[model samples]
Target: MDSDWRMWSRRDLLAEGMGRRGIQHAVEDGWLVRARRDRYLASTAPAELIRAVRVGGRLTCLALLRLLDVFVLTGGGLHVHMPPNASRMRSPSDRATPLAGRGSREVVLHWVPLLRSLGADDPRVHLVDALAHAVCCQPARHAVATLDNALHRGLVGEPEIAEVFAALPSKYRIVRALLDRRAESGTESLMRLMVRAAGATYDLQVVIDGVGRVDLLVDGWLVIECDSEEFHSSWHQQLKDRRRDLALAQRGYVTWRVTAAQIMYQPEEVAAGLRGLLAARRGGR
Candidate 1:
């Protein structure tokens, strides 16, 4: 499949001199799927590319980060970049499907010009540009999560990010500076960002004897572990976590576990609890 043509509009085919009937023929022959009103996807197109086109925008921000295998807090909905002058723009509410109820595929639009540098092989915004857009458009912690994963994957480096930061608005520059590649998941990155923003000192992925690597070590003795469903869904995994916590306790580290729910739905409460713990630790010391 030509990567660029894997997901495209009817106009793209018409521009190539293939009339409307040609597109219809391809659909009938099972070569294409009508992804949305005007968007079409090759039968073999990647899900992300299909989603990008279906949303009437290029895949970008967290969407591109997902394709790069970077850690992004999932379920924030589809991220797409639509050119300001693009035709047939509609609000997300108007685009919802009744059969799907609220719809799992809610689209988040980033209004911007299409980057000219995007290669023919990609239906998404170029990585650097997407990262820049992500940093500017998302909350600082969420943006940092994407940056951390990009760095971890070796998809981007500090220098490229620095260059991107140079062009970003002043508010997002601080998030770029705070990006730490050591974060293994979006949850950990976000929690760490919140802790720091709340004026506490912490270290990420800190190694302790007999405890493997803990997620975040704050104020010297408190260990914070960000637990996703992947870590805690099984009884066996819960037993292992308990054992790890016991080991850390024996070694003079206090282990605290945070869940995806607390991170997503109760961030302020999470911050408050972290602050209380840090304050208590300081008082004890």
Candidate 2:
């Protein structure tokens, strides 16, 4: 099997008993490619990594988080991390020419300093550094969800979170209080934020009499199920959603099944619907 894509610098290759000529031969054979001036990466590495290097920086921000299997609020383009003093960067798709002022839509360049040193030869940014960058890159609510996702996945510990905060400005310190490790998914985390933003109090991962465990329970009568965006979503949803809703309904609990899209894009409408429902419940009494 191929190695774990550990960076192979020129010196590393030489130390591994491979001659300069052998290295060139491997490159010619398409077995390896020079990722940077003196660094090498296996051709079998993920295309995104290769492209990030081609774009003149390390894969970072949401791109790195996604590669680490951590959750991100949204997706688009290649997020490349350039040095704070980096200049004359190349395009994400075309490295031959220098990128214009700022960057292109296809490549979002984060010209920020790293909190932790991601080695010079590494093609990806460090996790804590990426999370910090993500917090700056995304909106406040989405940033909290991203952090919650990192915690939910157990990707970082206290030290790592501390490092991430050290990298961010003071304004983001408030977000530290919003994290919820109990959040099973980014969608669920975002849903919880929506509840808080709507001035509603809720219990997380609460078990009702017959509804099993729920994402969020508001006012002891509402169950909000955050249907995260996942592959086979419809199929997985059909497995238990209606059954859970029916069971909750029978027990006098109202199940509000919130789709990922609605929570992510149309949050105001969801909050309004929530308020309307809650007010109606109060009025009925």
Residue-wise lDDT of candidate 1 within 32-134, one digit each (tens)?
Answer: 8776676676878767666666555677877677766776664556777776665554333333432232224576677755444664335678788788877
What is candidate 1's local distance difference test score? 0.75
* CA error at residue 113 for candidate 2, angstroms: 2.9
Error of 1 at 104 (Å): 17
In model 2, which regions exceed 4 Å deviation?
Answer: 1-4, 84-88, 229-239
Residue pairs whose backbone atoms clash in candidate 1: none
* Cα TM-score per model: 0.77, 0.88
Off by over 4 Å in 1: 1-24, 34-40, 46-48, 51-57, 66-69, 73-116
The residue pairs found clashing in candidate 2 are none
Q: What lDDT, from 0 to 1, does candidate 2 have?
A: 0.80
Q: lDDT, candidate 1, residue 173?
A: 69
